[model samples]
Target: MQLSSFKSFPLNTLGRDFAVGDIHGMYSLLEKKLVAVNFNPQKDRLFSVGDLVNRGPESSRVMSFLGQPWFHAIKGNHEDIAIRSATDPDYMDLMLRIGGAWLMDKSPKEQARIRQTFTALPLAMEVQTPAGKIGLVHAECPLDSWDDMIFLLKAGKQDALHLEEKLCWSRRRFKDRDETLIQGLHALVVGHNVVEGMQIMGNTYYIETGAFLLDGEHGMTLLDLVALKPV
Candidate 1:
């Protein structure tokens, strides 16, 4: 089944909403962080900036985590690789080189299940907060305005595919240190490039603190959307 490229969620009035950076298969570490925050999945929601799989020990368990009703996510570059690698032989090498060796161990059935889940994920998501609307993309927003990106993504044409490439893989914003605030969003959250710590540039937030890194300094980052601060 074809999935829409964008999804919008109403304000989570029942409990707090949190946005987490690229998990990269570190489910255990993520669990520890969630415990520290006293996350009650019954009422709370966890939104992932994507890159939910690959690079860590538990990449195989991504489907189980994604199954949780309280967890929401967008498709990241790694997920794109997972989708393509299943059909396009050319992407397999690229996937393995980028720490997706875990996929090789999965049975054909499991791989298909994983691919289907990735294909179902939207490229962009928006969640309403008292502060305003928060936008989430796996990487940088290729366009100047959040609404424009949403419009283009909804179009889902050839140009939208190009923008999707940028959304999942481009790091130009962080590399150039672009501070241009995207219009029509209270804040834009993303993950892909690892930063030394959680950072904010203009209204965009970079929260991926390199959960895949084995170094002691880096761990999973879960940012509270309402407070716009790391938990």
Candidate 2:
């Protein structure tokens, strides 16, 4: 299936909307936290900030979550690595070295299925919330304006490829402590940067609390887009 480079979800008028940080394959931990928060799949929707697989124990279960109707996600850099490794021999070592060794155990057919799943995910997505529109990208939004980012991603040309690199892999915003907000978005949520907690710079929020890190010090973060409180 050819999915768009950008996707937009209408407001969840029926129930609540939640956005989680880089899950990194801690499927059980995520589910436990979801139950703690009383996440009702029957009504609420869960938006993932990408990095759904890798670095953690349960990466194999990623496909099950992907199949769930209520779960939505964007493409993370690890997903990019896994996709490339499936086709290009050069990327295999990189993928295995960086918490993706679990993929090696899968058969060629299973690998292909996983690759197709990640490839189908868009680089960026937005959800309409009662507060306004919230944007979700794996790492950083390259452009200052959301509209420009969407247009460039949709074009999928040479320039878009460069932007895609920044979208999936850039850390300039978090590294430089950039406080500039992207226009046309009420708030932007991103992962890929393992912040101490949910760091709010301008309107952008970094919510990945290193779920993959087994050190008791770090855990997952799940933010309510409707309420948008850091947790």
Candidate 3:
């Protein structure tokens, strides 16, 4: 892990509303889907559910797309791992095992740019949607472990690292506990866990439709916030 001494990027609020699920390095598929949906990079905003890298053949390509101005992404576990590796020299080995190898395989200048981009992603985003306040996090909510929901909410966005484990790793079974029920946020959209199709669990939607699916098989779930529909 070659730790870069750059600061992380803050979360940006954009668009009337648009969202996409886990990319997992399937850059070509993502490009086609964006075209199929007639995505307008300027007027329409794009939100990634996370896991923008790893397990796919083109992590470098995936990062390049994410760097575009039209994209707004929260930090997924993969990004978190890369960040840690980037900042901590000791974790370099771990990073390589995950997806660092692919990222480093790029040209020197390309790798440098990717490192800068990764350093700047936000940990989570809270969007005002018709369905109530929809929170876009990587995976689960950190509020699960806290007995006081108000306290966690008050912590604000600065505490991303403290909540990393749950935000970027927890899955459906882990989030469907009594703790989550008591926390009472409107809905949380996340990725990391692959599903057969898009899932609507309570108000939270898991949209990682396994973009890495091979054999000429790949799928993505697009969420239209205004229409309250997933296509």
Q: Write the per-residue lDDT of candidate 3 for residues 51-97, one digit (tens) a residue.
A: 88887777877877765877778778888777676568766688777
The candidate, 1 or 3, that scores higher on lDDT is: 1
Cα error, residue 139 of model 3, in Å, equals 1.2
TM-score of each: 0.94, 0.94, 0.75
In order, candidate lDDTs are: 0.87, 0.86, 0.65
Q: Tell me the spans in candidate 2 whose CA falls farther than 4 Å from its real position.
A: 1-3, 158-161, 214-218
Q: How far is candidate 3 from the true structure (C-alpha RMSD, Å)?
A: 5.4
Across 158-186, the per-residue lDDT of candidate 2 in tens digits comes to: 15448878988999999999999899999
- Stretches of candidate 3 exceeding 4 Å from the true structure: 1-16, 87-94, 107-113, 144-161, 172-185, 214-218
The candidate 2 region of ten consecutive residues with least summed lDDT is 152-161
Residue pairs in collision within model 3: 1-92, 3-86, 9-120
* Cα-lDDT of candidate 1: 0.87
Ranking of candidates on lDDT, top first: 1, 2, 3
